[model samples]
Target: MSYPICHEEIIEDRDVTAQLDPRGDVAVLVPAAGAGVRLGPGRPKALRLLGGEPLLVHAVRRLAAAASVHTVVVAAPAADLVAVRELLAPVAPVTVVAGGVQRQASVAAALAAVPAGPEIVLVHDAARALTPPGLVESVAAAVRSGHDAVIPVLPVVDTIKEIGVGERVLGTVDRSALRAVQTPQGFRRGVLTTAHAAATDPLTDDAGLVEKLGVPVVCVPGSEHALKITRPFDLALAEHLLAMGR
Candidate 1:
């Protein structure tokens, strides 16, 4: 089955307590419909099992745990909307929507479902399942502190190389100036909506869309625990990390 870019299905847990907290002024959008080709998938990346739970479950659980986050909207696979909603109902009060073909479209769909109360919106990846609540709070705090855009990043540590067409190394590229970026990338509600409205090309991260609008994106320290699970090796590593209580 196919769904429109803005198709949405809201699922709420009445038993769950009010989502608002002392600093609850943030909403998180999760685009989770990507097929995990790299992981040699049996299921969609977000639905893949991790530590006995779906990656989406782990991700949303953490996001819901954050004091600043008042809402979470997930863009799930069109066919799996019911399943995804059922999966998340016990975990948190979330609104599930049919995701679009591309990640950008899914984000846009999820963004549309965000209610008005939250002024700070965050775009997070479901593949980063182990991202901690602290990181969520940090990103929201940065946005709340008056920054229009905020993202988590870590310094690149590996030796860099510039490659040619035939897989030849042209030269050693500078790594000092490069940083590895991560999410839940935060933005003021107006800033994010405006960026999306003005977006032409689909970029890998929301910050890239904002960059095109001449907005300065601030970066905070990212945690190793936020490593994205993309491959089988990454899954194993995540399992190990989980066992180690990371």
Candidate 2:
């Protein structure tokens, strides 16, 4: 497949949710191995408390509920592998394994554990604790519909600026051309494996690795509830969002 390197045109999403039935065909990988230095230093980001429970607990629980998803694999910190397994046992049946130091390595570890049956694989950040099952299904649906790769995105509302040294504003960035990418990023299982095999330099997201191979990635609508829990304020906001039944 020839991937377009150009920006993808936005396709508005409908209100109706997909009735995804990817049973035994979709595998989800959650890379929960980050130190999360921004969320205030007590525990690994995924293990940190959110609404009186670990963030990983909320993330895995949601993915497991999706009808399309059959397997959920977690990559935990080397020290917390056993603890993470115990924490998630009651919420959902997940496979917990020791994770590598970097995010990409952790993803590769979880990817290797995914069974042979699933043709589609999704890489979701455990930090997106409140991601709705509908959004998960949407990405998976796109892949099942023959897209090689897909990701969820929200339009950027705030004005963006480019800064230079000495704190001087260099130029204003066009926000209209930009969309904030979110996860549960979906891919063909073979494409994901190939991307990992070819990766050399470090990257923040798996889609970028696929992009390096010149594959075009499509974008789907994302929910505000899928906000990543990064800073102290973000955690507090997530707590508030959860309280509102979001």
Candidate 3:
């Protein structure tokens, strides 16, 4: 079973100085430079307010709490590189670099900044700001356990349907074999590097690139707290969840 950290725990964790081992086995890359058009006009998605703090701050606090994570590399908007560094300095030790126009580019940039230590690398979304430390450790543990690639997933709870050209439903699809994928996707450093280098078309997630190489991606149970904040409703929902102290 997966245990998720509450909002209170996250706030407390941020106050303590992170003592992550420099030689730890995992490096986390957060691609946080997206414009978040779906979320309406405001600061970049990662920099948006979450409980009075930027979403990036909340996300990094959780990442720092994970024992297996040694290094954190964030790809921030090019114009906000310095600002992002300053914002995160008080929260945790992080390397901030200028992000590219696209999410894949941001991940590639952050991945390039990773040092030589960690053999396992995780690509996480800054939008999934409330992801727990345990979930981060779990993904890293799965990668450490000999999996070439690993992703956290939740069983799909909504009914599915196949739609036709005119928005007509073709048939109801099976839900039992489907899952909703979550971030903190883990991969062997070399495997991720190679996949990024060979990438041609832009894919939604890094695992897709690995899948093209015929690599098997393993899945572990995911946390509900790891929801991505895209639209205004999502932000509101996150606020409610935090208020409830869940």
lDDT of 2 by residue, 124-154 (tens): 9999998888888888888899989998888
What does each candidate score in C-alpha RMSD? 8.7, 2.7, 5.9
lDDT tens string, model 3, 1-246? 222211111112121223423337889999999999999999999999989999999999988878888999999999999999999999999999999999999999999999888899999999999887878877787788798998888777899999999999999999877777889999999999999999999999999888888788888878888999999999999999778764
Relative to the true structure, candidate 3 reaches a TM of: 0.90
Worst 10 residues of 1 by lDDT: 2-11
lDDT of each: 0.86, 0.87, 0.86
For candidate 3, the lDDT comes to 0.86
Best candidate per lDDT, number?
2
Residue range 21-80, candidate 1, lDDT tens digits: 457788999999999899994999999998899999999998887877789999999999
Candidate 2 vs candidate 3: which has greater TM-score? 2
Number of clashes recorded per candidate:
0, 0, 0
lDDT of 1 at 51: 87
**Candidate with best TM-score:** 2
Find the 10 residues in a row with the least total lDDT in model 3.
Answer: 4-13
| Quality of model 2 by C-alpha lDDT | 0.87
